[model samples]
Target: METSSRFEAAIKKLYTAFHNNTLNPECCKQCAVGNILDNTDSWKYLSDDHGNLSLNYVGKVHQTLGRKFNGYSPLELLQIEATFLKACGFQIPLNHTNKRPENPTDNDILFNGLSATISLLCEIDNIPNVMDYQKLFKYKKTTFDYIVH
Candidate 1:
């Protein structure tokens, strides 16, 4: 799959923000994941009105799709990001029993969630949507995958 320069720049900006101490690592993770989910139909079940991931979506994804949480079960998506924060050596508020104390363990394990999200977006025939997850997120838009403009 190709990559999008805009999306790559955005994620790079986020990384810079985290390094500059403007945006914390947890928020960086959420924004990264949220932006990904937002650009897809999974936004319906994964985000709230403000486009942030909600506990409701968390419960739904877990219950409906069996997408297991790496850290906390009964928690907000932000909490999951926070878990990643803790694993990354940041202090979390009201910490719980972390499933993986060393989180972002595999470069955010993004494929795990994105794979499931893609499954939900596809039809029973396993055909991918117009907004191919990787291509879209990577900002690699072609006429075949999606409209250029």
Candidate 2:
């Protein structure tokens, strides 16, 4: 498969895993590692360089959900988690940002719950993925060794 296509597939796999609640914390960590391996060069841009990609991803998620997660609520964390998953390359429709929400659907609830758990795991563990690390600390001057080791 082409590089872009491979990346898309990986994103879809992660999305599916998150949506299904079939992905454990270790699985998400592995996914993050795989993403780093696949997009190592992107890390240079995310860290010690351009940090806009991380902002874009987070902004897009917040914009879409119409709320900023305070990092305390599981639902908010899930939205952020889904955004991270989409950053892998799922092509989330940004145009849906302003849409009205009648009620949270099952898929929405599932994704939200899964994202919350995933986000907590990511925050607490060593995400061995360089890209993930970059996204998490792109604006900071801290070295990778300090964050990962």
Candidate 3:
């Protein structure tokens, strides 16, 4: 299936970060959007609080200006981060007392987070989720002929 260059780039970045032990739900520079943006924290300025789906003033300005970072808008980046954090077992908006995984860096936790983030990315682009394997299990009908003696 063909995907946009942005989608491909984001997947590659997330894959590298996941395997490199750089993906962290609590860190701005290592979060899903951060990795997608090449480990830059600039995207954090797009929102006032981490794990927030709403864009702040700066983010609003960027969105209004049609500015896209790494092929994602500020709002999209925030949504992606929120999705990752939530899937990783953290409460939205990131409070210290909120429910979160005991080990945020655990591979399983991070994998779940990455999976959700990737799903959201695909949704944003109106493409099929890359991690979805259901299609592979679908049965297809084929015609066959049998001759009886």
The lDDT leader among the candidates is 3
Clashing pairs in 3: none
Candidate ranking under TM-score, highest first, comes to 3, 1, 2
lDDT string, candidate 1, 1-149, tens digits: 34344334434544554444343233333433333333223323443422233546555656576453322132334443433344444344323443323443344443343333334323222454433557655665557566688
Q: Which wins on TM-score, candidate 2 or candidate 3? A: 3
For each candidate in the order shown, give its overall lDDT on alpha carbons.
0.38, 0.37, 0.92
Best-fitting candidate, scored by TM-score: 3
Q: By TM-score, is 1 or 2 better?
A: 1
Better model by lDDT, 1 or 3? 3
TM-score to native of every candidate shown: 0.26, 0.21, 0.91
Task: Give the winner by TM-score: 1 or 3.
Answer: 3
Q: Cα deviation of 121 in candidate 2 (Å)?
A: 19
Q: Over all chains combined, what TM-score does candidate 1 have?
A: 0.26
| Per-residue C-alpha lDDT of model 2 across residues 55-135, encoded as one tens digit per residue | 355444454666522222223333344454453333332224433224323356445434543443444333433234456
The reply for model 3, stretches above 4 Å from the true place, is 140-149
Question: What global local distance difference test value does model 1 have?
Answer: 0.38
